[model samples]
Target: MPTVAVPQLSVADLDPATNLDAVTERVAALPDRVDVAVFPEYALTGFVADERACDAALERDGPELDRVRSVAAAHDLAVVAGYLERGAGDDRLYNALAYVAPDSDTTVYRKRHLWAGEADVVTAGDERVVVETPAGSTGLVTCYDLNFVGDSAAFAAERVDALFVAGAWPAAHSENWRLLLRARALDGVRWVVGAGRTGARNVPDAPLTEYAGRSAVVRPDGHVAAALSRGERDLVADLDPAVLAEQREFIPVLEATENDGSTRRNSRPGSRNKNGV
Candidate 1:
């Protein structure tokens, strides 16, 4: 079992320096047994829908993330954080998430399903991202991506043991956020960790956006293991590998999904089984 943390943070808009400081402080305060900490979408730069996004974007190899990598190494834990990415030689910015671990090179996953106003600011990613983590093979997705059932199916076909979702979902539509997270977990028979931004955001062009502060960890059976509401706090829980083993054996959603062309299992040979990874 890997101890995972879902931190609901109120981001500092267009201020990477301040948010990065908070990230460092929060993770540094965690107990040694916590294997990974997942932060909300745009945790570093907050939510940007204006020209300021260009000013706020950070390079994957830049100093901002190098500091995060140093923290990961020093603490012996992994960090999943969301930020606006300045892709190399690419004209547009990307809403990307970085998975930084102690033993592996950093893995970056750009948000594929751009939310309503976000498309005007950043380009959507072209492919899916699934990477190995302390919690086993984990798939990364952003806020709007949770609405697409097919994305969850793809992760299911990949036989991911867990899904770490970084969300900046609005407080108005918070119920949909909770429902989708549970559905995704039920569909894949995998754990779903959703870390959402809390409090209010005031940007240049967009209206004052109030984020749903429900940072939660949903078990394979679609039950919430730990959740937080209405404030900034860390929701920590131990993700038991045995839970995946028991759920997959009971439901076998991935095996049933192989019937359709929309998704098919990628052969990992000995990488996974119905009981465990």
Candidate 2:
């Protein structure tokens, strides 16, 4: 069994500098070597109005990401973090996750499933992203993307080794966050790591939202391998490729589904005839 070490970073009051530092400190605290580290949605800046959010929006080739690339290079680990990103036109933005791998250019995945007011704030993504790593191919998704099973299944179809979720999930619906994380992992039969923010935000005039900070890493069998409390900031887990292989071999659900939904089977090997005989 190949064990992949990963961590979930949770924080409040998103600020690029501080959160970046937090990532550094948390990764440093890991006892063994770390393969990857994930951060919450809008970790660089909290969700806010376009004008205010634009102030912190980063360009694909901007210095902010340069700092992230440096972090990956320094630690020799793959880093996935989220931030509001400047789109093609002015006043346009995308809730995006940036994947920075050591000695590699960053790859970005925009949120495809927007929450209630998210579409009004940022444009939805039309595509998904998967990256190859030493541990396995990794797919990226954001908070609301978890609600759409197809989004995760799409990655599963590609047999991605792991899924990374970056979220600013609210405390009011934390159970949904946990259940969805496990479901995504179990249904896809892949490793899943979720990173969520903590703390309360009450911008004047803006509606207040409290974060649950329920970060977790789940195995392919719908079991939580590691998790942090509502306000905790860190979680570590080891994803075993052997376990994933064993589960897939046992059920082979992915292979069975490749035939599409039209395929049917008898309740028992000889219980039914093809012509209903």
Candidate 3:
């Protein structure tokens, strides 16, 4: 069983320093029994509509991330936090998740799909990364990525044990957030751990938009095991591998349809890249 904690917190708009402090304190507060702590999208740098986003983008190897890594090392738990990344060639920016572990080097997963105002700000990612962790093999996805079934199926083909999601979905469509998570869980018979932001984003000269704020830990059986409607509370739950094993044994959903439903049992996994976004 892998104990996971999903912290439902608000992003301090364009303020990485304050967010970094929160991340440190939150990581330190988790119980030793927890193997990982997941933070919501833009956990460190909140989103902005225009070029001001460039100001929020941090280098992957920048001091900010080093600080996060140090905190993870000290706490002895994996931390998956959403952040804005500055491209090597100064391309644009990327909506990314930083998977910082105690024993391994940090793994960064960029968001493949950009939503609404995001397409103007960040470049899409090209690869599908399944990171192996102490608890299990897991895949990462940011906000808008949850709506795509192929992304969920792509990880299912890789046989990932879990999918960790970082989201800042709007309050108006909160049901979609919960719906899509369960759909993905059933799609792969795997655990879906989602951390969503709460509170309102007060960007200058723009209408204030409130976040959905319903963070959830969906079981392999597609049940909502634990969740937070709104607040700064942490949703902690132990994901039992046996539950996944039993679900696979009984339903065998992934076994029947492999790799985004393009390949059935004996078929070769699709040659083309399955765009998961």
Candidate 4:
């Protein structure tokens, strides 16, 4: 089992190009044996308020993604980050997660679920993507995508070992952030590694987008395994798929649910209410 490093990125001062450089440097500085480095949503470009800004978004093989690939290859690690994506033919843009593996072609997962005001600028994605890596079979999703049942359900069907979420989730809805992460972990029966942004971004008409940075790694049993500080910075934690299996076997909650869809009729294993009381 290898540890995944979640970097709570602060984009207050850095521009897209500067952020890429900073991210590359940060990834290079991590422990040499890390299997994956996860970054917050819109890690390269700060959240865009208007469609015009999204118009300036980069392509998958553009300079921004190229930089991420270079660092992942150099560090011998897989990298996952969110970015605004521009389509080649039309003016449509997408909120996308890019998975870059060392010496491999980059894979992009467009956000399947759109947030409020997001559909006005970006088109919704139709499919879920899972990339096979040395560490595990990994799936990627953006902020609001985690809220959609279909997205994670698709990943569950794929039997992915981990779900990497990159988000600009705001602090105002911290509870949603926490609950959604846990729910995704439980439903997918895999580790949920979330990397969220901190500080504020200028979005027109809406309040400044701020991230709570409760970014954490949730185990298959729906417990917070490890977390970063609330504001910003890097945190790492080891993830063992075997532990997930152990917990699942001990309780077999997912298996039971699969057998009978009635939650009220079945006694859940290791089940705790939200308060943990």
Candidate 5:
């Protein structure tokens, strides 16, 4: 069991060159003894209307990623963060989550589902990825993906101990965000860590859309273990795998579902909706 930190900071206009330093500094201040730190989706590149901006995205070995790697190595912690990754052969890009081990190569989890206004520029990933870490087996899913029941079920099938979700979820849909996260935690029967942005983004002629930073960590029992402020902030909490295992054994929800397809085992029934993460 290790503590994981979720950072909910403003992206500061999607400029990675200038923002990476600040982001790194903030991450460095996180609890040094924690096992891992998770950052928001597109934290380096703010949500943009023009998808072409994703083309300018970096590679896993790019400077932006290198900075994150350095932080992980410095702190001796696993690091998970999202960025836009340019495809080598195609013009399209992938919204990717990079899992960097201290002083090691990076593993990537590309977003499998694209959101509205993203089809033109982003390519969808074909499969889910779960990486074995020092702490445990971890799965990565972007914000929109969590809305899909199949995705979480697949992770459950994989027996992932933890799921890391990064996003730019808007304030108008805060309740939806909370519900979706709880649903994922309950359905997957695993720890859920969600890190999202806070503050507003300006659209050309329309009113600004505020990103509600309700970053949180949920237990296997679907209880909120820890949370950050609804505004800009950083928060961390210790996660005890032993406690999670105990709870799973007591409830046996996932096992019951697998054994008999008994709807009686689900905490929430008939709530499956596809809005891919």
Candidate 6:
């Protein structure tokens, strides 16, 4: 089992220093046995676009993320955090998340699916990012990617054990966020750890909005193993491979559907049976 922590933070008008410091402090406060810590989307830069957005953007090897890497190394755990990345070009930017592992190179996962207005400011990522860890193989996804099940299904096909979702979802559509997290976990049969931002954020050029901070860890059976309420808190839970195996033995959905590349279409309900049956 892998102990994972999702720190729910209120990212309202926080500068880069304060944001990074918040994450560092959170990691410092987490349980020593926690294998991974996932932070909310735009936790470092807040949600800003246009010229101001570019200013908040950071290079992968820049000083900003160097501090984050140090935090991961110090904690001796893998840290996943969202930030604005300065893209290849001067004007380009990416809604990126970096996975920093102790004694390992950081892997950046750009947001492949952009939100409604994000395309104007951020370029969409064309590749999927997954990494191996001592606990298991972990995959990454951003806010809007939850709407697409195929992306998560792809990870399931690749035998990903856990998925980390970093999101800055608004308070209005929080139910959708909850539903998607559970759905992804159930459908993919993998542990889904979701970290979301809270409080009201009034970006310089963007609209003022409040974040929904229902950060949670979902089991493979679509149940929330652990969750934090609408505030600044940490939701830590263990993702047991035994539980996943047991659930898969009961349902066997991911293995059957992905390995065979075909799905059973039963007209009647309760037509399927368990793997051991």
Q: After best superposition, candidate 4 residue 137: deviation in angstroms? A: 1.6
Candidate 6 Cα errors over 4 Å, as ranges: 12-14, 258-277
Q: Which scores higher on TM-score, 1 or 4?
A: 1
Q: After superposition, how far is residue 106 of candidate 6 from its true place, in Å?
A: 0.6
lDDT, candidate 5, at 170: 86
lDDT of 3 by residue, 104-223 (tens): 367778888789878877788876666776557787888899888787878888787888999999999999999998888888888999999998899897669999999999988899
Candidate 1, residues 188-249, lDDT tens digits: the string is 99999999899889876768989998988999999988889968888889999898899999
What lDDT tens digits, residue by residue, belong to model 4 across residues 1-277? 7778987887642267877877887797788768888998878776565645564587776777778878887888888888778876777788777777777456777787788887787788775666665447777778887887766666666666788889788889978988999999988788889897887776555556667888899998889998875766787888886887786677554443332111111012112124220
Best by lDDT: 1
Q: Provide the global lDDT of candidate 6 against the true structure.
A: 0.80
Residue pairs in candidate 4 whose N, alpha carbon or C atoms collide under 3 angstroms:
none
Of 1 and 6, the candidate ranking higher by lDDT:
1
Worst 10 residues of 6 by lDDT: 268-277
Residue 88, model 3: lDDT of 68
lDDT of 2: 0.73
TM-score of 3: 0.92
lDDT of 1: 0.84
Which of the predicted structures, 1 or 2, would earn the higher lDDT when compared with the native?
1
Clashing pairs in 6: none
lDDT of 5 by residue, 128-192 (tens): 77776654677778989988887777677666688888888888897777778888888877888
Off by over 4 Å in 3: 260-277
lDDT of 6 at 211: 82
Which is the winner by lDDT between candidate 2 and candidate 5?
Answer: 5
Tens digits of per-residue lDDT for model 6 on 1-277?
Answer: 6788988888645378889889989999999999888999988878665567776777777898889888988989988889988865466788988888775357778898898878888999876766776457777889889998778777778776778999988899999999999999988888889998888877666788888889999998999998887978888888888998898888777765553232222222111123200
Q: How much lDDT does each candidate structure score?
A: 0.84, 0.73, 0.83, 0.74, 0.74, 0.80
C-alpha lDDT of candidate 4 relative to the true structure? 0.74
Better by TM-score, candidate 6 or 5: 6
Stretches of candidate 2 off by over 4 Å are 1-14, 88-91, 259-277
lDDT of 5: 0.74
